[model samples]
Target: MTSARRWASVAAMLFALLLAATVIPDGQVFACTPTRVWDGDGPIWCREGMHVRLAGIAAREMDGSCRPGQPCPEASALAARDALVNLLGGAQGRTSTGHILVDGPTMRCLSTGNARGNRTGAWCAAPSFGDLSCAMIRTGTVLRWDRYAHGRCRSR
Candidate 1:
């Protein structure tokens, strides 16, 4: 890997370790309370104004399509979406894009970088669920996306 990418990966790992250990002061972590779920693997809208895509995983698109190179779990799109909503606190409504509005439990995340569109790629952990990506994978709703995982999912 390029030196810059290597350093970035190292940085993300350190940050993730810090977050998982909870060694830093509470407010020091980038905490987000989810306000919406776009799918099983997220673009989880956070009340904190961060649009977070759960790093290290992929689920079906809202219309049940999986990207050509992504890991596509056997679960249907709605099933995966609902699983995420349940992980969060459940949906309050739906947006025009069919994303679910939620009042989910707060999460602390380590930002890896930018994801597709304007979303931030992050490995997030909710209080009740521990690691969100791992939880999603356990539910059989999402697949472990190794390309972007950077070993985060395995660590959890």
Candidate 2:
């Protein structure tokens, strides 16, 4: 072939090689190991195989009793705690004071009175989930039953 044709062919081959390199997945580059744990209020970037804990609050009373047009008198703030335990496949236990222990995450109940009682709070943490970013743990996931006894099932 001519010199110009040969150079064109070489350029095409180089371009194809570059494209392949960009498209192909590099196992070494993609492979990720477990992340370390840090203290404080934040998220944790964890590996798939690593274990973690999410701390939060649990509702003290969750009775299914209410009247029409009223909220439930008892609310359980155990959404995130429950979800984390389910995801990690860990057992849940409780302390003598009724504190829930799901792996490393501890869920404590703040109040246990009527619907208008003080709202409960919880703190959830996963050491091996993601960085201490806002996206890691959501507020609603660690929610409080604020509108207790305010919905349609309040009287009951």
Candidate 3:
């Protein structure tokens, strides 16, 4: 009887640990796979078409004009889209699946990149590139979300 009771106690502890593992979330990487990407606002069609705002950045639509006082050529938004496609290695293959790691409004990730620093700033990263939002900022395709970014981004 004593041996049987000890075995049961061990089993209960194991079960509790398993339950905790399932309930606790991964805090570091909010990851996903996307099938389509939107031109404006840098959202993607992923996790079954969830609206995923690209954590800490914003972009113009493919047909929208550049921001006022910004000297840019016509259809700059289209160029931005193409730049994104190229950056993601042709969009369909790279952005389509298994490359996007999102932790923000779309994924309900409570603790994503700089999230500790700024509550609203979640982040998305790929296997190769470190941070997608920062990359776009560096390439002049997008700007940091001003409230969270402070003055982190500058023009190319």
| Predicted structure with the largest TM-score when compared to the true one | 1
- Candidate 3 TM-score, C-alpha based: 0.50
Clashes of 2: 25
In terms of lDDT, the poorest run of 10 residues in model 1 is 19-28
**Best candidate according to lDDT:** 1
Clash count in backbone of candidate 1: 0
> Could you tell me the C-alpha RMSD of candidate 2 in Å?
19.6
lDDT, residue 73, candidate 3: 35
Per-model C-alpha lDDT, please? Answer: 0.81, 0.29, 0.49
Model 3: which residue pairs collide? none
> Which tens-of-lDDT digit does each residue in 69-135 have in candidate 1?
8898899989998999998878899989777999988898888766755677788896699999999
Q: All predictions: root-mean-square deviation over Cα?
A: 12.0, 19.6, 11.2
Identify the superior model by TM-score, candidate 1 or candidate 2: 1
